[model samples]
Structure formats: C-alpha cells, structure tokens
Target chain A: MAENLQDKAHELAKALRESDEFQALQALHEEVEEDDVASRMLSNFRKVQLDLQDKQMQGEQPTEEEISQAQKQFEMVQQHDVISRLMEEEQRMSTVIGDMNKIITEPLESLYGTPEDEQNQ
Target chain B: MAENLQDKAHELAKALRESDEFQALQALHEEVEEDDVASRMLSNFRKVQLDLQDKQMQGEQPTEEEISQAQKQFEMVQQHDVISRLMEEEQRMSTVIGDMNKIITEPLESLYGTPEDEQNQ
Candidate 1:
C-alpha cells in the first residue's frame, strides 16, 4: 500500500510538472536567468531577504532603515520586465503547488484535525 | 526555462514521494482505509472538522462546548491504532510537502523578496 501511494504521489508530481503554471514559471525563470542585469539584481535581492529572514527567525526585528532599504531594492527589481513576469509566474506555480499539497494532506486532516482545531481547543 | 523548472519540480516531487516519510504515510493511509471502524470514525471526524473550519473562516468562533466536543472526539479517534498511525504519517508527509514547497518557491523568494519584507514595510 505504501508503494502504491508512492506511485500515486509520483504520478501527481508528473501531472504538476506538466501543468501550465509550472511551464510558465519555468519559462520565465529561464528568461530571467539569461538576462545578466536581472539575474544579478535577483541574487542581490535574495541575499538581503535571506539575511532579514535569518534575523527574524532569531527573534530580531530588522531595523526600520534596513526594512526601507530592502523594500526600495525590491521595487527596483520589480521594475525589470523579465523580473516582474517571472515573479507572476512564480506566484501561479506556488498556488498550484499549494493546491496539490492540500489534496495530499486531506486524509491526514481527517485523522488529527486542523490548525484551527488546535487553536480552538 | 519554464519547461526545465517544471522538470526539476517533477523530479523533486518524485524524490519526495519515494522518501521513507512518504512511504510510511502511504502505508498508514491504507491501513486506516482497510479498517471499517477506523474508516467510519475518520469520515465523521472530517465532516465535523470541515464544518468547524468553515465557521472559523467566516470569523466565527466555535462555542466552548463545541470545541470541547470536537477535542474529545478527536482524542477518541486518536486512541485507535490505525488512526494514530495515520496521523503520524500525515504529519511526516506534511513536512515533506512543506520542504518541497520551500525548494520550489526558493527562486520566487529570490525574485519578489520574503514575506517578512512585506510585514516589515
């Protein structure tokens, strides 16, 4: 039964890959990667973002200035055509993946309840 | 590029499905399904859970008794071997899916900035 479920999961993965959302996201990623300027900008943005995340995870809030600087940089990156389109595609792909996850976890929801249940109790 | 990214996502999904965690989850799901008592209990639990979730989504808090009743029912369900195993498997599978989602969204993270950025600003 486990093996069979594994097979089903694999099948679901295949279907997800074949989805238009994934295809669009992949295409946009490639387009962004090919552009040196956009690629460089994205890398820098990610570095700052990760740093901020690490700080937050450690219970440190980013300074106001740091937050402002990050937001400005983000907006600058979004100004790029390839970057903007890639972001859109990424969002679509995320939604698709989220839906898939919901389906996969439906059985579990039955057994243990949901986050709301935990919170309500 | 989109096609390639899709391929990578598919590969990640395949790896996830084949993982020990996923196999365990799949095995437990089958085990629960095969037991009539456990299966019926799960079905009822899910219906109640969904209703609760719907109400919460509408900004309604369940009454104290409702919350207590649901918790009691959940605990009863958990006492069953198949149900408990299934719950454990579900958590494991959810973790795997979460990790996969993180990986899949990493590129997007690099592009649009993190959620913390939005919150900070």
Candidate 2:
C-alpha cells in the first residue's frame, strides 16, 4: 500500500536528488515508458521533494528585524514558486479539459442545435 | 452513447433557460442531491448555457471601430468569465486534492522514514 511507499518515496526522492541515480533515472524517464511504475513514482517523488524543500525553507524562523525581513523575502519567493507551479498545472489541465470539452461538445451542438431554436421549435 | 446525449443536452439547456422549468429546477437543484445524475447534468448544462450566451453576445457584428470596440469588450468579458470560472473550479479541485493528498500521505510518511536517513542507514 501507499502507506509504506510514502517513506520509501521520500527516501527515493532525497536519494535521487542528491545521488547520480536521479540523473540515470532521468534518461530512463525519457526513453522508457512513462507509465512504468518506477518512472512515474520517481517523477512524482522528485516533485514532492522539491516542494517539501521549498516548504521547509519557507518556514524558517528569524531572530532580528533584518533576518525577519530576509525570511519574509525568502518566504515570498518560495510561496510564489509553489503557487505559480500549481497555477501553471491548473492552466494546463484546464486547457486540456477545455480542448476535450470542445471536441466532445462539437457533435453535441449538431445533435442538439443552438439554444435559440430549441425554445421556438 | 454521448453522441446522442450531446444534442439532447444542448436542446435541454435551451429549454431550461427559457422555460419556467429552470426556475423550478433551480429550486430543485438546491434541495436535491448534487450527485443525482439529473441535478449534476442540469448544473453542468446551466454553465454551458451561460458560456454559450457570452460567446454569442461577444461575436455580434460591429462597424469599423465602435462595433469592433464593443465586440472586443464583450470578448474580454466573456473570456475572463470563462477562464476565471474554470480557474476557480481548478483551485477548488486542487484544494480538495491537496487535502486528500495530505491525508493519504500522512500514513505513507510513517511507513517510509526521512530520505536523509534512508540513504545513510
């Protein structure tokens, strides 16, 4: 189950980030089937580790006003990174869904006809 | 098949919007279970109806300048409406997914352990 995999995934992510294994895996990710469990898991873990690092860095505490200001700056950068990444993902998904919606709805339009006519007829 | 439903869906969308039925259905939609096929379908249809209306409104023929300006305004409003609505939906879905993911990953963390220790130990 994923319960066990969670730790393993984190470990794998950390190892991959620091280790040459990730570089090797990256090549495989491109050439090998993306659907391969190892490839997918590795890819997902890589993103997870990066996000976790950003989150950890963003949560740092500062003692002095200058440090606090620097911490805030760092937090903003991390926050922006996370939010922008998510927004980009959402935009991509929406675009894909929108395209699918268009394709799927095209035939529907022909079958159903325009709304104006539906009321009169 | 969806092929047939597509046409029926458009026709139904028009009817619901024009008829008093939509008002009645709107009331029903609130009381009825959201997961109900009819309610969900109606909800989805309403959205489609509104988007189509906006698109149609924006496409009206304009004279050399004024008409084009009006059309452009209409188009921006329509585009923003559609994009913003979709973005809102995406944000909502992401929030839900993020929550679920946190819940799901909690157990996984316990099972795996920290990445740093995984490689060393």
Candidate 3:
C-alpha cells in the first residue's frame, strides 16, 4: 500500500510510452487510421476480433467458417504497409506488457505456486 | 526497446512485492492454506471456479443451479476470519495491478483514444 510503489508503476509506464516501440506503434497506428483504405482494412480486422470475443463471452464457440473468415481478414490487413508495421510494433509492446505482468504477479505466483510447478510433481 | 525500461519495470514489481498489502496477502494466504478447515473450504471454492472456467472454455455457460452453488461456497468462505481478510488484501493488490495496466496502456489509449472517449463523440 505504499504510495511510492504506485508512483514507480506510473513512471515505468511513462518510460514505456517514450520507448521506441511505443512511439513507432503510435505513429504507425495514426497513419493507418488516417488513410481511408488502411482504415477500412483495419476496421474489418477489428470487427472479426470483436465478433469472436463477443461469441466467447456468450459461451459460444466461433465456428470453423468464422475462424477462417477472421484469418482472411487478418491477412488482408497485414498486407497494408502501415498496418503491418503497426502489428509488428504491437506485438513488441504486448511482449513488454506480458513481461511486466509476469514480474508484477510474482508474489501471487510464489504464494500459490505456478501451474507449471504443480505439473512437475 | 530500452533495456532500462524493462529494468525499471522489474524494479517496480519488486517495490510492489515489498509493499504492505502484498506482504499481508502472502502471510494470510499461507495461514489459510495451513489451516485444514480453511484449506478445505478454499479448495471447494476454487474447484467451483475452475469448473466454471473450464465450461466457459468449452463454450458452455454455467447453469443457474451451478451459479447458485458457487455463490453459496463464496459466502461460506467469506465467513472465515483469515479467508475474508485475505480476500480483502487480494482486492487491494488487484486494484494496484489494474491501475498499473491503465497507466501502462496510456500510449495505446492516446493513439486510439479510450473506448469511453469514443462513446462520448
């Protein structure tokens, strides 16, 4: 509950925002959004992702056809110049967040033990 | 990607672990685990949660009766002294992580605007 811990967290966030990956991600994302063709392509890709998420939330499986459709939309978006670079940078940023999450949750993992730790027994 | 940014992230995590909320959560969690009655109650509560999660992954919703059973077990666990306190500390820790996530994703938010920001337009 220390206030400084929260402040440190925010500072790390600011540093990440200033990182090259984040800067590129923001710039490319903006460029894609501003381009009519790229925006439509990205919009289509986002629609498929949201549709799958909605179905999962409703406790329904996405159909095989639906999955294939989504894959096609993803590939189409990836063909865009700015969209492709944005996705690459997005992956890098996601990795940063994932790493942060693992580190942040280490205390909980130590208390309960990881699922991987259980499997080794 | 700055190495310092990642190093800073790990440092923030270390700070969080050293915080009072995390310390209390860990101690209480272990105390609950070592108590036979509390352990068993917690086990039952966890089992229901895992079962519901499994069902959801398989695209099946929990029935009303199943939901009621899970709720009953949750209430029962809350009746325990250490369990209740542990849950309270867990909430606090979760809030810390949630706040971190919001801050960490600010760059993305700036790029795309928040979902709330979109709704207001």
Clashes of each: 3, 3, 0
Give the better candidate number (2 or 3) by lDDT: 3
**What's the interface RMS deviation of candidate 3?**
1.7
- What would you estimate as the lDDT of candidate 2? 0.42
**Per-residue lDDT over A57-102 for candidate 3, one digit per residue giving the tens place of the 0 to 100 score:** 8768899999999998888877877888888988998888787678
Measured by DockQ, the strongest candidate is 3
Answer with 1 or 3, whichever has the higher TM-score: 3
Q: Which stretches of candidate 3 lie over 4 Å from their true place?
A: A59-72, B61-71
CAPRI-style docking class of model 2 based on DockQ? incorrect
lDDT over C-alpha atoms for residue B21 of model 2: 29
Model 1, B17-95: lDDT tens digits are: 5668766777877787798889899888877898899988776889998888789889988898888888887776766
Task: Write out the backbone clash pairs for model 3.
Answer: none
List where candidate 1 sits over 4 angstroms from the true fold.
A117-121, B1-121
Candidate 3 residue-wise lDDT at B70: 96
Best by lDDT: 3
DockQ versus reference, model 1 = 0.07
Better of 1 and 3 by DockQ: 3
- Clash pairs of candidate 1? A26-B1, A26-B2, A27-B2
lDDT-based ranking, best first?
3, 1, 2
- Residue-level lDDT for A78 in candidate 3: 76
